[model samples]
Target: MTAEAETTTGSGTTTTSGRRPGTGGVTARRWAPGTQVLWRYRDNAGGRVHICRPVTVVQDTDELLAVWMAPGTECVKPVLLDGSPVHAEPLATRYTAPRTTARARWTGAGVLKLARPGEPWSVWLFWEPGWLFRSWYVNLEEPRTRWACGVDSEDHFLDISVYPDRSWLWRDEDEFEQAQRSGLMGPEQARRVREAGRAAAEVIRSWGSPFADGWEHWRPDPGWAVPALPADWDRAPARTAP
Candidate 1:
């Protein structure tokens, strides 16, 4: 649903980091709170971006990167070539349908994304119109690759929804299965995604840091302006060596 940043040690304790974990031994500088950045996801089949949202940084330490995607922020999202919403299509042909990007505004309440570095999933907080805390959503995906403009990951389709009472349920399972059947994901990749889902479920069962972190009470700064969707929202990120 959304994304952010934080750090965890080998023992699973949360801590702060001045620089993000780097590839090729080069640490990446963290974005300051309130900085604008693009959060994006690439299509499962091709490396082309299919979803993009501009969000304001809430926190950017190595232990966690948090961001607020304010209501009304313009964004790019996938849609059927017929200009229909992707979810409106039948599951049988959803992933097989021709699709394209469409610019739209994020409606309703915004989301707070909490992500730990190198984790395969990010947790998101949602609220109702009056700021009534809704629930936490675990979006299982690949570890986000960070670049100067923002971060990118490929969605794994499988997800979990955690409620206030600590009860949780799997979400998008049909979509997950459909994706594999549509050839968007190979059998091996699907297996790994399922493994990641089980791993995330274990964390949920234990009531881990993010779910217990009190992010539901978190609110955005009143002074922070909503980030604009930039013209180059789909710009390719600079490559980082493994």
Candidate 2:
């Protein structure tokens, strides 16, 4: 995703202007529903971006930044052949799972992710077009680190799912346990993660922010095209000098 230039202000707001080399200026536009932007996450503060997804803005208000990931959008993700945690493998092969891009599609229309400022996880609402309102998925990941083009974070490998009744379940307990056993997460870290999950559950119980914000009524613009994965999805360094 080459750009003419990017500038970040002291307040942590970033702006990218001009056309991306190959994508033309498809990404240069005002922030509004149907605008396409890359949502990415780095491995560390200055590490290479290992995950990237292009999504359309569903809502971009001060209280919430909601985006939609349409079905079959190309995305970069880490996976182990045996389905082991990426950090569980021996050091020699830990990050050698063969960098690959795959189609990321949900079971239905797509996923609508909602995030608030300084939150540790974003609430993702899933559904089928006509039926509506399936479930809410809280993806527990690092608080987003913003970049000129989009936001970034590392997935914590654990998540919570809240049904319409407000009851919740830990979606990837086995993986979280495995990550802990594999030394990827220490005891204290695990405890904090659990606390974060609890915090999210409380929000669900309260029907907070996006939940009460009426985003479920949101629909993408029919004229908006499916965004293509930037050519640099896997290789770009999110921050050149932090």
> Candidate 2 versus the native: TM-score?
0.72
The clash numbers for all candidates, in the given order, read: 9, 2
Per-residue accuracy of model 2 over 110-194 as CA lDDT, tens digit each: 8888886567899888886684788888998887655445677777768988777767788878777766765667899888888
Error of 1 at 228 (Å): 0.5
Weakest lDDT window of 10 consecutive positions for candidate 2 = 21-30
lDDT for 57 in candidate 2 is 76
Q: Residue by residue across 30-131, what tens digits does model 1's lDDT show?
A: 666778888999999888998999998888755787989999999999999989999999999898889999999999999999888888899999999999
lDDT of every predicted structure (CA atoms): 0.85, 0.68
Clashing pairs in 1: 4-65, 5-64, 5-65, 6-63, 6-64, 6-65, 7-62, 7-63, 7-64
